[model samples]
Target chain A: MDALTGAWQWLTTAANWAGDKGVWHRLAEHVQISAVCLVLSCLIALPVALWLGHIGKGGALAVNLSNIGRAVPTFAVLVLLTLGPLGSQGEWPTVIALVLFAIPPLLTNAYLGIREADRDAVEAARGMGMSGPQLLLRVELPLAYPLLMTGLRSAAVQIVATATLAAMAGGGGLGRVITAGFGNYDTAQVVAGAVLVAALALAVEGVMVAVDRLCDPMRGRRRAARIGRGPGERRGARDDDAVAIGGAA
Target chain B: MSVPWSLTAAAWPSGQVPADPGGPWLPQAAAPGGADCLVANDWICGAYLRTRSHELLAATVQHLGITAASVALGLLIAFPLALLARRRRAVAGAVLGLTTVLYTIPSLAMFALLTPVFGVSVAVVITGLVLYSLTILVRNILAGLDAVPAEVREAARGMGYGPARMLFGVELPLALPAVVAGIRIATVSTVAMTTIGSVVGFGGLGNLIASGLQGFFKAEVLTASVLCVLLAVAADLLLMAVQRMLTPWTRPRAGSRSGGRRTRATKAVA
Candidate 1:
């Protein structure tokens, strides 16, 4: 009973604190870190992904490297880099770490999207006397844009969420408030920080979803429907088609 | 070509001895060697080993345990939810969207939020980790399940198989590849994110890195970072092996084009 009361008081206090100017500063810092990390990662990853997709070479290596990046915990990487000769113990290390963390999705999607562009369409463009660069820019890029965008969306969300780890290294963000709360045994602060993060993430995701809809209006309806139908229903439907096709083939 | 005497001397008159003192004549510092070097190396190594093992062990166990538990919980929740969601498209979409939103919440913030409520316990850590995994698991499981053939389901139904039997006997086996792919992704993610749990004093590999940063212990930090990369690679390989073993049917058989054709068909359907 006492513990519950204590938790309730803490929650109320933290909620009040959240409305203060400091909390807004922390939120701004968090958003800035996330944005910088996302943009930097996309810039680095997108070109490489496009090049790899165009050449159809080094994709396996790039993908595996990205996977390795995904596997290595960002927090560990931040700590390691910060302690190294880089001496980057602030937002920079956090940004670098998040950039590394964000690369795989962007790279994978861009590579896959371009590589998997309709070959027939490329052939048709070639028949029309399109040059290599022309074909890529005119045909391949447009087709790959949607997938690339998807990767960026995922990266954005991931960076926003992971940016909090920056706080643990004595950097500033909503994480700072949460950590302070934890240290002070203030449950309300912790809850408030978390709620803010959750709200922030959802808002970001909503924006991305809206962006996805605007960018690929044709896919908007189908995409939601498809994503909603558990992979099984889709698979079952596909397998049936496969068996039929296999028999025919 | 009347050059100044200082310039000529400094430039070294062709084929003549230069008055300049700067040449190979400047002796480089001798590299440290023998017992002094060995003793320094030993001291460094000793210092590292002494200060490192406790942090390393604590971090490793915490990471491995939390990741394992989170992935397991995620799978437990995701599989059934996926199954249920498959039947109801609206419900499945909502669940997936919810989880996706949950997944986007930054880990640090989530931990911060959870800390107050759960107070830095293993429960808080696992809950956060599991929530992260839910989105990926649900998506993958659904994808895997969707990969199953309708005919197979119909045939099973024709043979009087119930929904449970059809799922287990036909849909699951066929969808194993996609489902396993999802698991592989979830596992990799869980392993990486488990480090975030360290913020709550759960003591994972992230702790090692954190301490290294605070104390300026480069060796410890490097050791921890390398271990994490290696762990992720090892886990990926392990899961790949497991996926292969579990779904022998998906494997391309020797001297058969059936697998290729099936793959194309699956792609078309997808």
Candidate 2:
């Protein structure tokens, strides 16, 4: 109980510190880094994903490359780039690193979403004399929008979280508060920063959920119906559908 | 011919053209100067190898061991929670929402948060890594379980299978492919994030790269970066192989368009 009280007290103090003007500046810097990185990653990845999805070639290679990008740690990449001729030691290097980190999900999800578009719908469009780009713009992209939005949402959250590493490199953000809290053994400050980040993430997720619902209005109805059904009934319905599909085929 | 040679040389002018068109160029002449440093740094070369090889090996082992342990724990916790959350849409949404938020917390901040209480050791590092893996792993597992055909579970129940038995025999097996795919994603992510352990002063290859950058040691930085990329590639390949091994039951049989169609349909639904 005493330890819990102490922790609470520490948290309060930290929150106070976080509210300081200097800390807010740092937080703003971090948000800027995350936003820039997210935009840059989307710009780089979306076009490539769209192109790959459209062509339906080099997808495996593009996905594998993006996976490799994810595997490479942001810190290590930042450190390497900062030590090289491009040796930017500040926010730019961190931005570049976060951009690399953010690319895979955006690229993969977008590519997968488009590639997984309803083939029959696409065929129907083509049969009506739609050109390749025309079919993509008029038919495929609209249907793929919800999944694409999910990818963007994922990318946004990831970049925001990752942007904090910039603090280690002396780039500013909410991470500086966390890092400083650690250095000073200020538990409250650490907790405050962590809580803020968590809250921010939740806010972003809520926004995304809303966006997802907006993109797919039918999802809500289907989800609600699934929920209202008893487990056994739900299972029966799914099984029946599968059996029907199998029989038809 | 002798008289012609003198005339050709005189006409060309020494500054305007080289005596031989195919002669080694100025840059070639400067190559030896570059090689001199490398030749003189032989002892440093050996020293570099001795120090780096030991550190690299130690870091690699520690990283792999920690990552594997965390991933295993993450899988164990996530799978059951996912299963329980399957029918409870509200609970699942909340869990998914929480995990997604958790997933987005900067690893560095999480480590920093842990360090004050845990004080910068292996325990804190492992805890952070495990937490990071849980979000994605749980989401994937739940999604996989949710994806199992309703008829399969109904069929199992009709066969007098209890909930536990049905889950183990029917739902889990069917969901294995998606679960493994999630695990693959989690494993690769955990491997990468383990590099952040460097901030706590626990040595990983990241530490080498960090120090190399701080001290302007180009060779060390290059070596660390190259090794990290190699490790990531190797980890991805290993996880892919493991995914294939574990989900052999889910593997497509010969000439079955069914497998492709099912995958496409599920993707559309998602």
Candidate 3:
């Protein structure tokens, strides 16, 4: 309880929120780094994942290869980069490391999203004289939207949490706050930093979920008879669950 | 040219702790002989092989111990929750929701949160790692239970098996593959997460990387990180082998190749 109170005090203290090293400054740095990594990872991963999912060739192999990304520790990558060629290049090393870390879930979820689209609906769209691009942009992409958002949310949260490694590597982020706390043996500061990170993650999750809910027209169907869900939402929450398990890890 | 981190770390002023140096807070500085051999770039691999072989090997064992113990503890917690969720539909929602929320809590934050209560020890590390393993385990466990064909349960009942006996004798074996997959992901992930435990002083191979970073010992950092990746792959493969051994029936007998491999693979994760 004292620890909680102390953490609250540390968080509320105006002095801690001022200056170049303030909590708000650290939070901005954290968000900026995370945004850079998230955009890069999506650009590199999503198109390939979506295309592969569209053509439906080499998918298992592609997913398997991507799984290797999850196995390698991102922190190790940061350390190696910092200790090696990019040691003095500032935040590039951290950015590269985090982009790699964010790739697996983004790629996996996007691929799974498109691939899991209702084959019947896709076939129906094709039969309706829809062209290839039309089928994808019109039919498949909307179906894949919620899942893509979920994947994005998961990746965002992870990158935000991990961008703290930037601080350890002499870059900037909220992790700097905690690591700084550790160096000073300031438990209250460490707890406050953690609270900040946790709150940020949950906030990201909540916003993504809201976006997903709003975009997904199938939201109110659960009570509308199982039949409504069958044709509309193909394996809704369950697909997200599998993504969370397989990709988020 | 890429100068080793030591030069930069040494150049930093002492008062700036973050920039001053980087490494494990708990582990002592490397021995003089070990540090000397690793001072140059070319001799790094040799230094690791000669001096760090034992330390790296010991850290690997400790890493495996911590991961295995955490996963096992995860299983103990997940089973009852899964069982409860299976019996009561209402409880499943709450239980799964709680575990899912717990899963999203990042490892570093988790360590910091638990530090106030548990401090920097194996207890804190394992506890956080176990929470990570829960959603995977519980979901897979439920999915496994849900998958036992309805007719199979009917047949078990016909054979005079009670619900408990039916679960133990009939359902569990069939559920083994999914359960094992959950365990594999959990264990492999825990190995990676254990590296973060170093921040709080309980890191296994992570300590090597940490201390190596502070000392600018390339061999130490590279070896430890490689060992971590290797450990993850090895743990994953080992579980694959165990799954193969346990589910001998899954292997294709002759020419039924198409669905056999893919279904099992998907089912494990699905």
Candidate 4:
């Protein structure tokens, strides 16, 4: 209880929110790093995954490879790059490390999403003499939108969480607050930093959830379908969606 | 790279100290104009492994111990939670929602939040990991239970099987594959997250990697990382094998679709 109050006091301090090393600066650094990594990961991963998922060949191998990537600890990759020649380059090691960490989820989820898009719709589009890109954009992409969003949300959240390691590598982030607090043995500051990070992560999740609902092309159809279903089945379907989001993260 | 002549002459009473023997592929450990001992900074040093074998072993053991305990505990807790959710529609949303929210908490922050209560102990790591595992385990277990064929339950009821007997004998056996799939994912991820425990001073290979990063000790970071990856791969393979052995009926034969469907279902969940 005392520690909680101390953390609150630390968070409330005006002096702590100013200057280069202030809470706002660290939060900006954290968000900036996470955004850069997320964009890089999506750029590198989404096209390949979507193309491969479209062709329906080699996606298995690609997905399996990324699964292996998941087992490679992000911290290990970050430290290895930092200790290697990349160490000489400022923030390059951190950027490269985080991009690598963010790619697997994006790749796996995007590929799976595209591959699992409605086959009947694809057939219907093809029968109507639609071009390949037309079939993909008009038929497949819309169907896959929900899953694609889920992947993006998970990847974004993960990058935000893992960006904290940047502080360990002498880069800037909210993690620096916790590390600095540890340096000074200021438990209050440490707790405050943790609270800030947790809140940021949850806020990110909530925003994505809203975006997912807003952007889904199937929203009306899904809601109508839900209304048609019995209450018990409706709840089961909802649970599965929540579980998928959690699993992706 | 050969040792410089001046330093060699001064250090060795003999005219020259021999430079490191040239290997076609390997870099010289004892590079001149820098740290004298290769083990102190080299990327891959045999000497460091020979000297610190005990320490490496201890860290690896601690890592394995923590991962195993956390996943085991997670499964134990998830089983009941899954059952409770399955019991009613009202309870289902809350259970799944809570676990998902818990799953979103970042590891560094999770530890920091936990430390106030657990005080930098192994308990903090274990508790956090168990919470993390709940999302996967509960979902998979519930999925498995739901997938059990309605006809099978009816047949068991016709034979006078009670709820307890049907769950253990009929439903659980059928659910084993999905349950095991969940375990595999949870265990592999736990192995990776276990390194984060180093922040609290209980991270197994994480401890070595953390310390190594601070001083830029390449061999320690590289070796510990390799071991951590190998451990995750090994755990995944072991669980897959257990799934195979326990659910022989689902095994893929020449024309069997059951195994293929199971694999797809598991992938869909992940």
Candidate 5:
């Protein structure tokens, strides 16, 4: 209780919100790094994943390859980049490490989503004389939207969490607050920094969920019913579960 | 070259370098062994490994132990929660929601939140890891149970099997693959996450990685990171073997690619 009070007091302190090292500055830095990494990751991964998924060739290999990438701890990647030649570059090491860390989920989920899009619908669209790009954009992308959003949500949250390591490498971020607290043995400040990070992560997750709902192409199309009945729906649910499991890790 | 050199110097000023210039923290300084790669900060110095074998072994063991214990405890806890959720649909949403929220919490923040309660100890690390594993384990177990064919359960019930026997003998056997899949993911992710534990001085290989990073000890960082990755892969493969042995009936046909696909999909995450 006292610790909570202390943390609250630390959070409310006016001085803590001022200067270059203050809470607001660190929060902005954390959000900026996370957004940049998320965008870069999506740009780098989604096209390749979607393309391979559309071609229906080499996607499994790509997915499997990315799965192996997941086993490499993000912390290790960040530290390795920092110690290597890139360590001297301003924020490049952090950006590159985070982008690498965020790629696997985006790649795997997007590829799986595209591959798992309603095949019969795709066939019908093709039968109606739709071109390759037309079939993909009109039929596949909408169907794949839910899983793509799942991947984005997972990646976004992960980048926000992992960006704290920036402080460890002498970069600016909310993690700096925690590290500084540790240096000073100020438990209150450490707790306060942690609270801010947790709040930011949750906020990111909430925003992603909102975006997923708002941007779903299948909106107002009785998606619930489509997701409820038929053999196709059952398989879709199972695949979504598998993808959720992927994101959970 | 000059650009990078100046940046490096700016990052580390003179006062930060301790009197013993060649100490673990100052990788570029002159050392007791003037000609050694360890003093020169090579990424794979055999001498460092040869000298620090015991320390390396200890960290590896600690890492392995923490992972095993966390997953095991998580399984024990998740089983009851999964069973409860399966039996009573009312609380299912709450259970899943709580775990998912817990999963989203950054690991560093997770540790900080628990520190007040568990203090600076391995228990704090273990508890956080156990919570993290719940989202995977509970969902997989539930999915595995749900995947059991309805007729199979009906047949078991017709054969005088009670709920307990049906669960233990019939349903669980059928659910083994998914359960094992969950365990594999949890184990591998746990191995990766265990490195984060180093922030609190309890991370197995993480401690070495952290210390190595501070000192810019290339060999230690690279070696520990590689070992951590290897450990994750090895654990995953071992569990895959276990899953296969436990479910021989589900083995893929000679030319079928389904088995490979399922494995890859289940291992979608770390």
Candidate 6:
């Protein structure tokens, strides 16, 4: 399509990739803002969720509360913060709103991940003289890795995509380019910005998947040890799990 | 507190109208100098209603209309996709994967991408939102189909129930809770995402928030923000009530501790 070509041309312009308005600079800004929000979200949400999940108490309430938070629409929250008292705090309003936006999934999945770890492995760990923290660190967290990573992946993808809200608050990111394109009525530039954000989101997902696979403590061993199941039932379960991943997505 | 404690409380003379929190207790302070409106409290109440209520009402209707149409369209599309996906795991994976990519596209980007083709109409907003609602709705529908227990299917077949009859009478009834849960999630999330439509000047309550923000009218911003949250929460609860009313068959099955928790967790995460 001519539109695609125009978008490509817009993206290909070297001038578009330089200066404060450059795609690269905005990309960096986007990543920085998302990374900060993600890390801070993980930091704030994970501990409380994992603790509750570990203790097997209050997980439902915490997840529900965060779900309420999630429904509060990040754009609304960001607008209020930016236009209110914190308006002059530069990027903090965006950061804080994003961190809040990312919390529900992080909390829900982390708690669910921990609480849903194999009961046998947990009992075995406890029977083996593993203390609370040790079991959580060694057995629980590692076993919970896939779901946790899924949560992280979900949160990370969302943050990367929505980080453009930074522009609304007078901060800088890839969103700025799109806003500028809109103001100028340049459809090509707008489409180009979309392409950039989409590419960034997909890239983040690819990297997260690799990291999830690589860091999984029980990856190859679990599959190998379960090989005696004659493959049929095992395959069904693996497929079911893939469906679970779909359900989460 | 003006709690509506009894189901029939509204029938009582004193309780007929109920109390409003927006009554005398709310902030009555005037706007700071250089703000958009005359007095802040006036914007919060009298003046905001007197001048801006009509516009607010229009935007709210637009917002509601866009959300309703998007989700309804999404449901219509997702149903067939879910059915096809149910036939094969590979199909399910591929379909779900495609929708996931759609979901991952930023709301802003989605709007921008649509602008070239649809030119800022309701079609643009609706299409983008339908794409978003699909992943969850399709996934949930498929999950519901998959969850129909094997023995139930076997028993239905043993009773001479044909494939179509079994699907409709047995599996569908069984799957209603999950399906309804999915709808609830989709609707609530759609309502929230609809606010982003204001970026291009078409979102309902979102228009108010955008205009208020640009104009530095705190009361307008506050009211719109709270209304958006209320809309989402109310939609969620209303759908949940509908699910409860329609799917009596699924309730006892959800009696176990783990079953309820799993449902809650799934709804929360999704």
True contacts kept of each: 0.81, 0.61, 0.40, 0.56, 0.57, 0.58
lDDT string for model 3 (B170-268, tens) is 788778888898888787778888887777766677767777677777877888898899999999999999998987656776657535644543343
Docking class of 5: medium
RMSDs, each prediction?
16.1, 15.8, 7.4, 9.2, 8.0, 9.1
What TM-score would every model get versus the actual structure? Answer: 0.78, 0.74, 0.87, 0.87, 0.89, 0.85
Evaluated against the true structure, the overall lDDT of model 4 is: 0.77
Clashes of 2: 4
In angstroms, the error of model 3 at A90 is: 1.4
RMSD of 3: 7.4
- Between which residue pairs do clashes occur in model 6? B31-B40, B59-B204
Q: What is the fnat of model 6 with respect to the true interface contacts?
A: 0.58
Q: Please give the range of 10 consecutive residues that has the lowest summed lDDT in model 3 chain B.
A: B13-22
The per-residue C-alpha lDDT of model 6 at residue A89 equals 83
Docking quality of model 1: it rates as: acceptable
Clashing pairs in 3: B22-B214
Instruction: Return the TM-score for candidate 1, rounded to 2 decimals.
Output: 0.78
In candidate 1, residue B168 scores what lDDT?
Answer: 74
- Count of clashes, each model: 17, 4, 1, 0, 0, 2
Scanning candidate 6 chain A in windows of ten residues, the lowest lDDT window is: A240-249
Model 3, A83-160: lDDT tens digits are 988888878888888887787777777887888887998999999999988888898887776667767877776787
Best prediction by lDDT: 5
Ordered from best to worst lDDT, the candidate numbers read 5, 4, 3, 6, 1, 2
**Candidate 6 residue spans exceeding 4 A from truth:** A225-249, B1-46, B252-270
**Per-candidate interface DockQ score:** 0.37, 0.29, 0.53, 0.52, 0.61, 0.39
lDDT over C-alpha atoms for residue B189 of model 5:
87
lDDT of 1: 0.66
For model 4, the superposed segments whose C-alpha errors exceed 4 Å read A225-249, B1-40, B259-270
**lDDT score of model 6?**
0.74
Task: Write model 5 residue lDDT over B82-172, tens digit each, in one string.
Answer: 9999988777888988988898888888887777776666777889999999988998999899887676677667778788888888778
Q: What is the iRMSD in Å for candidate 1?
A: 9.3
iRMSD per model?
9.3, 9.4, 1.8, 2.0, 1.7, 3.1
TM-score of model 2's chain A:
0.77
